[model samples]
Target: MPDFTATTPHIIPLVYQPDSAHWFALVRHLPHAVWLDSGRPQSTYGRFDIIAAAPQCLVETRGANTSIRYDDGRTDESALDPFYLLKKYLPADQLPEHSNSNLPFIGGALGYFAYDLGRRLETMPNLARNDIALPDMSVGIYPWAIIQDHQHKTACLVINTELGQRLGDAYNFLEIEQLCASAAKNPAFHEAINCIKSVQKSFKISEFESNLKVEEYQQALAKIHDYIRAGDCYQVNFAQRFSAEFSGDPLIAYLALRQALPSPFSGFMQLEAGSVLSLSPERFIQVRDKRVETKPIKGTIKRGATPEEDAANAEWLQNSLKNRAENVMIVDLLRNDLSKHCAQVRVPTLCELQTFANVHHLVSTVTGELTPNATALDLLRDAFPGGSITGAPKIRAMEIIEELEPTRRSLYCGSLGYISADGQMDTSIAIRTLVCDGDKIHCWGGGGIVADSETEQEYRESIAKVKVLMDTLEKEFGS
Candidate 1:
């Protein structure tokens, strides 16, 4: 890694959503910069939801025509290079050799970058044309070394651990007082609200059912059970499908859905012209300082409307023997997966039931120390498509999925996040997600299938998971 000491003074704070037209322009032109898009959908009401892109590399005390020509051809190449562009600006040697499961990044310390930059921006904030809150979505950037997959119409962004650290640190360092006060006065804030109003009426739900025979699905589940019984696999995450046809721009629909229901792992990714709106709540995997962690969510139960009823439902979910068993089975599966990539593997946490506003879930945390030569990419490849999504004996589960599922998953279970120059990476299990290919839009939802799993219950769970997407659209655009 080259020494970044000389360039430290040049680093400054940048706060802009990446999806906005202007912010996109800034990223296209800025050099040695970090671009982030939190995939939060645009809202027609309340605090203007934002899609911002900030040019961190161009912040300086004196203004120099900080603009560069955007080569449309370059966008294809630029989006693919996960590490090539960021490597130029980051100190490679300063990065750690091992990964960290606890901290954000495992390679170098980009957390400091976010920390220093966020603090500086606080002192000298950049003026924006719009008043939009950064989308409260998962944060990561694509590396600039990889080539855009024009065939798949997807781009890869690399995020270094240093950048991850920087973001985490900066998030903690934010001056909430100043931000809140500034938000009150921004005129664009009101404009953002109006935009939400204009589009709110356009939201609608489109529904569809699978062509696969119900008996076939049942047989598939039975096969999965047979595999478990034979010790071929301990647990397998089996899924079924339901899809819908959409008429408007898929990207636009995704944005509206996000505003209606923002999830912790929400993502908005532009894969060529097609985009994905994901509101997943599961963390697939995270690497920091040579340690790895995965939180697998297995069991789920829908929430009730009343507070008391919701609490009762959560309690019931927590006490349910079947839910607990499903959760543990996945936990064991994840432990074995981690064991392949790391040493000292252990399930420090197990079968912890967590309740979200919409549903209650059974979650467990597994951890391990990374082996030497383990890169963030290597971790993802070894554990591509998390265990919770894929049942135990992942390979067989996937094969069964291909046969049972009617359409390509596309970004349904695929990840969207940045891998930094320092090798820090975080990705979500693409659940509660919508994939838009032009006017056609499809969203997916399913749950783990175990030996004792009931067909009707599983069917309901799948629909329950996607209710937010359904309701958001109907409420916003009308049925």
Candidate 2:
């Protein structure tokens, strides 16, 4: 075990007055940058948004290879589990007490854990093709972060000065201090930051392609229904991948997506191979003070054109027996997952109506207290991926997903957020997420198919979920 020095972070207030998107614009150019957005000034689901760039250390896992890259030109290789490597940097007992309890994340690991990483945790048949090869996990250990508390309408540059001092990186520490000072003391610093201006859309105007045709998608749904009837599983989430030739700054597309469809758990991450723009509305899990909560979005219905229609749609989603059953199925699954590392597990909210920019969903909240000996990592490990997206009888549903979905799910249905050094963790299910791999950008949409699920309705539901994203990108970036 390595020794990590404990140090309370210093908070420097910022008067530049920037929202999560604007503050992120200032540091977006930095490598390995991440923005855990709260969809502030618009949505009411989230309160705190954390932004960090140029990590002091990066822990990325690809297949069985895990590498730790440090800022000072140091690289260490390990074959240990990615969770194990991440846990090393997050020592619960050694973390300094957070100076401000309002901030959810000060300094910690911020990144994405791809859904495919589940293969590493549980033994499953390798039936799915490994078509897209990306890091299963990519997280950076940030020494400093800009945390915005939307509830208080306050923002601060919080730095772990002790970690910097312990590393003897005086130059880096001084650079951060100077950066904070400049932002506070100089109004001109705003201009000094390279803000991305509106640019012409760069995506090809050609129609987006899907891995499964409408008929094929329906056929896949039929298979899931058969499985359910055969007593193989109760529900299985099936998704279709849509991709287009994209050639412009994905940041532009991300900016467009956020504006069009703001979500509580939305995030944007710059990775080595590409970038991730997630407008996810589902929260996979959150841990604070050893308390765990998982919000699963199981049922969804498109927003109606009129206010009356919207209200009626919300009412329908709330009362629909099918939707409520789907929500409960996942809630029960999550309760079971949390029980692996938690005590006094309970579902506080079940089948609650939550409306987003495009659709209304039934979301359930499952919470528990971590056992005395269990850590946040342990809780996450037992609940890899998420039950809502995976469906009931998680492992079996995953197997069915592998059999049905044509292409591999790279980042879709994964999680993107932060695990703080002080043992606080918050992550979102990477639903409504996009992946920019080289010249092609991929997007996925899916819904759970149950025994009584309608193939036609499920097909439309899948397309409806991501239609906004596809339309937004094509309209903005399509050449």
Candidate 3:
């Protein structure tokens, strides 16, 4: 294989199609920084279209020409280890690291390993080497590192075709603001929402049994546990069940869904056959001010119908010893991972439960200063798969995962985001995500399993977490 380094400026693009507009792109320069001023009107100081951050690292990549396919049957282990490859291409010493005192940049990069397929890789011809035609609408590549401001809207689209070039050159923050303003003034956004609602009316809920019987799954899980006992790995995330299928262009479904539910990490990526429509809200990793911080989400409890009930559930989750222990295990795991590349590592913030619109999570902040020789890539490699998903003693966990899980986890648990030419990087854990290929859609959800893990609760949590996506799909297409 060839070792390629990014020497020139790279433009990462993000494209999206609302109900009213044709596909549009958000473009920005890489390796830029964004400073968020919570109290200010415009809270941004970076050049990038979109930025997704993570609490810790969990991204992997198979190098060019090696055939260790994670999803497909092809298994070649020599594929560039994403962590190792990143270290060689983008080192920590060359990039800026964030500190606990300062804010950190966050983002993620997740998707099917299309690079493994020679034919698929051709479509996304590397811009670093050649000048290729871009879509009519394109956005800048997401900068990996930046300061996130919660006050102002910080979003961008990335373009990668002629259409993208035209849209990018004409589009800017001001233009986007105008578009959003106009969208808000008129009923376009609302109309789009209603359209999606109409489509969702047709969805029906159904369950299917796995062809591989429960015994098969049990055997897999047992092997995983055996590996765990053997100490070959620490925590391995295992998942089962391959479900969800449809007939139609996923892009259409993607457009409709975005209108109904707009997200900070909304993206439309062109791939083989069809494209991937992601509306993820999780950040995988963020680097800013020379300090690196990661927030791994471990626990989940559903929201209640009423405000009082919701608050009660959130409070209950916060005080749940079981959830807290799970969150803490990953927190400690992340601290040790970061310490590999930095000194003075600290877990100043322990398990603090945070709630989002959909579910509740036990979140903790881990911080560390990069050592003289460490690079962002080094930190990522040292802790490739975030512990929340894998469990403690990461390696053993992985072996367990391999044995328990029946299907290969392509982009479900991997990382997704961007890396800048300047060495700033950010990524997100690929959870609450959907991966589609033509008519087939694969979505995965699992929780950390300790010695005290309950098979039924764990099963329920996985199903509950996936309910949102399942419901969304049901609403889109009728049973």
Instruction: Please give, for residues 300-321, the per-residue lDDT of candidate 2 as tens digits.
Output: 9999999999999899888899
What is candidate 3's lDDT per residue for 21-60, written digit by digit as tens? 2212111111111111111112121222332211112223
Computed on alpha carbons, the lDDT of every model, listed in order, comes to: 0.50, 0.82, 0.48
Ranking by TM-score: 2, 1, 3
TM-score of each: 0.65, 0.94, 0.64
lDDT, candidate 2, at 68: 90
The candidate that wins on lDDT is 2
Q: List residue ranges in candidate 3 displaced over 4 A.
A: 1-93, 96-150, 153-236, 255-267, 279-281
RMSD of 3: 10.5
Model 2 ranges with Cα > 4 A deviation: 16-18, 92-100, 165-171, 184-195, 200-206
Q: What RMSD does model 1 have?
A: 13.3
Least well predicted 10-residue stretch by lDDT in candidate 3: 130-139
Candidate 2: RMSD to truth:
2.2
Backbone-clash count (model 1):
60
**lDDT (10s digit) by residue, model 1, range 183-265:** 43666643553454465444455655553466866676677677767766655665545555555434346556655555555
